[model samples]
Target: MIEEIRIQNLGVIGRAHVQLGPGLTVLTGETGAGKTMVLTALSLLLGGKADPATVRTQAQAAAVEGRVVLPADAPALVRAEEAGAELDDDGSLLLVRTVGAGGDGGSGRSRAFVGGRSVPQAVLGELAQALVTVHGQADQARLRSPAHQREALDAFVGPQHRETLGRYRTAWAERARVDTELTELVERAQDRSREAELLRLGLGEVERVDPQPGEDVALAEEAERLAHAEDLRAAASGAHAALTGDEDGGTDAVSAAAVVEHARRLLDQAGTHDPTLAALATRVAEAGYLLADASTELGAYLEDLQADPRRLEVVHQRRAELGTLTRSYGADVAQVLEWAAASGLRLLELEGGDQRIEELRATRDGLDASIAELARTLTLGRAEAAQRLADVVSQELTGLAMAGAQLQVVVEPADAPGPHGADRVEMLLVPHAGAPARPLGKGASGGELSRVMLALEVALATAPHDDEARPGTFVFDEVDAGVGGRAAIEIGRRLAELARGSQVLVVTHLAQVAAFGDRHLVVTKSTSDGVDVVTESDVRPVEGEDRVRELARMLSGQDDSQAARTHAAELLELSSVGR
Candidate 1:
């Protein structure tokens, strides 16, 4: 149910808020009083096309917002969640729309949000259909949409065929998945073969290099040592000679030994008197021994060192190969291996596609047979449901003053099978005897079409809907058009009957229809402040003097007349008892 509609700065009406109640609510006003603006605001809430002209003059923007109460299990909640929104615990959906940017002067935009989460305008539009249906001169033409046809039929069938349709849809979804896989496999089969060969060749090329993980550091150090081998040997030999004071023939061994003995004798003489001097003499002896050992090791190292060009060439070749793989994959051999593994799986799948195709063909054939059977069963179910729907619709038409107008549900073969079935069904009508029946799109007039649409809606009122979780609120802009007197009275009564389980709002000029409303709102125009529109609602239960005055004004444009008041009073009394 719609809780309230609040609009601001949108065309002629600066600001207006309407609090709606559950029953037949009527809106009556003089021409051009902006009564239609209310419908336009509702259209924006339903994701209708936006026009910059809707913005009030000198205003930067226009806005429309509405609050709706839904059932706990409403399908609208599921759609909201899919769009990354949540609903209130009380199942209220808040919708908002804004138009006209600062000063760009372009077509304004609109958006919807649920529980403070933004959603696509299309998603909100789909949900809005379940919350409200608008009937008017041009807007009522939407009743011809194929989607509406399917939905109407679904409603007519109720839950009797739900499980079967559910199964059909599930199988169709799986079939689509397989078809997509098959198409991709066929497109890439040759490419995968070529790619697999390239991977194998690349892997083999890198393997031949046999690159070690840390070998680059080790090889660089070895190359540096070999590059300066001769220089290093010369430096080491000079150091050895300096430390030993000429290793070959610079000093005699006996002289060196004598020096050492003299130093020790001097230390011994002072040792008993000075321990500090003895410690210095011991350190000099140890240093002389260390220098002698270093000279020996350096001589051996210099002889062993050599430069090898062949070894350098081998190291450079391995490094170059490793570099290629590193650039192609990553800076590591492990990463290259991982890439190869993933590519191999994809390659295998592609290579074996022909075989997979054969297997899928067999499965597809079996599914085709199953779907065919289900389609036939669905057609049978629709045929049965169609008959019952036609009967109910005929009954509603009679009450809506469409007497002798035959309503027919025509089910025919589709050019191709759909998820629902292989048949297309639509409502057709023959307005009178001897008149050939024609499809709704081709037959009904503006007012007749509106009434037909209403009949279908009333006939399809089953267990409400998952998206609504309750009966939808119906809004009729001019449902009573081309109707008057007894016919208008009957139409009003039928609307009131529909309101027993759902809320109904009608825009009409007919006093008979207006009298049936449980709540009445009148829209008036004033030029005192540059042509503003205002709507006033009488919240109290209208009866006796007040009801007669309001209906009298609607009837003859003069509520003060005694005769008009008397007639209006009689009309209300008759409607109350008839209802």
Candidate 2:
């Protein structure tokens, strides 16, 4: 519930703070006392659009802020925490919005901060939806909407029905998904045939290539060796000739073994004094042995150094095939192998048979049956709830000076299955006996609309669908606009009754209604520092003479009238006993 509302430089209000109470708080004043500014402030606090024009003439910005205290179990608190907004230990939350001067005829930029953290307007608006229900002239008319009627009916049916509805909706959604899949299967049956052929062809091509992991690297090395075979053989022959003398064709005719032996003898004579020469002699002997072996191997390789054209062609063809598959499907040989396996599996699924279709049909049937049964159960629950709701609202209407009105909830079959189930509900009203029953919007007067809204709210509050929140606060903007006398008193009584369960705020001109508030506020116009401003004063628990005078002023616009004062006293006295 809203604890307090503070407004500054907004419209006719300049630096005013109105403290609200826990129950019904009524605001009343003369025609231009700026009672509407309070509503405007509430609107801004609830994330309504702001305008620079709402700012006072000399002010640079307009600001509206509210403090709301939530019940321990309220969902708004959960949402607040989710939005990273701070909350007091006692579940109190604060909402603040500021509007500044516009740059290009646009409404000044507005922002909302929950606790002290900046929040989007949408987050604030969602919180407001659960915290406050505002019924203005337009909102009263909206009660007749079919969607609202459904929501009200659902709310009236209680949580058990809601749980059932949720289950039904879930089942229906599942069925829809399966139905879509089935439809696609049937529609693409021919297309899948062509795709299956393509997938088979691709699989066969990849399989025939038989591309092995690491095979590409090995083949690349082997191909490099084969391409340089001529250069390799020439280099090998020259090296062998340098290391070992050609048969009867080279000088230094002693075998490499004989030269190494001579060097070894010279080194032994020098002893360890020439360590470098001795090491060189040992290395030369090892080199001589290595050269002798290379020469023997070279003689065998020269006879077998010729390239095979067929083998080269085969390697190139194999490489091209692997490259084609790599470019088309895989990054490399390994990836191509994995792709082939997965495509084979997908191809098997696409090639559906009678058995597969039957299986899908059976699943779809079970889902459909569950949803349909749940829908019927939901519809029956709605009918029962609607009957009870109509009775309660009708009773409330009589108290609102609509004695002959008949209120009923009409449920019709849905055009198609929907998430809400298979029923469409609407609120119908017959203003008087023998009058044709029309929809709430068609025949209800503005005052009647207000009363109907109030009655519905009262009903919904008493029987909330969710345990997380009951109705928090109800706000009526001039709902009693065209009412007076007993009707006004009736409105006040209903509001007070509503307040017994949830907080309520009503704006009214009727003194009868205003006098019955648990707390009363008078919005008055005054000149502050040569500027017209609107302010509020709490008139609850008003005393003898002052109470009489205030009521008199509200009644006849004349505070000094004796007759009006007497009437005011009598009205308050009567209201005290009635309440």
lDDT for each candidate structure: 0.73, 0.80
Per-candidate TM-score against the hidden true structure: 0.78, 0.82
Error of 1 at 434 (Å): 2.1
Q: Top TM-score: which candidate number?
A: 2
- List per-candidate RMSD values in Å: 6.0, 4.9
Error of 2 at 100 (Å): 5.1
Least well predicted 10-residue stretch by lDDT in candidate 2: 535-544
TM-score attained by model 1: 0.78
Note the clash tally of each candidate: 2, 0
Candidate 1: 10-residue stretch with minimal lDDT: 533-542
Candidate 2 per-residue lDDT over residues 1-579, each given as its tens digit: 899989888888877788887787888777767778889999988888877788877677888889999866678878887889887666679889998866554457788889878999888888888888888887876786888888888988898988898899889888888888788777877888888899989998987888888777677776776788889877876655555655543435555545666776777667578888778768766766776687788777767776766777777778888899989888888888889889989888877644567777899999988988999999999988888999999888898888888898988898997988999898999887788889886777777787888888888877756754455888888888777878888887888888886788888777787777777777778887887787543222344686678789988989899999998887788666223
Give per-residue lDDT, candidate 2, residue 78: 81
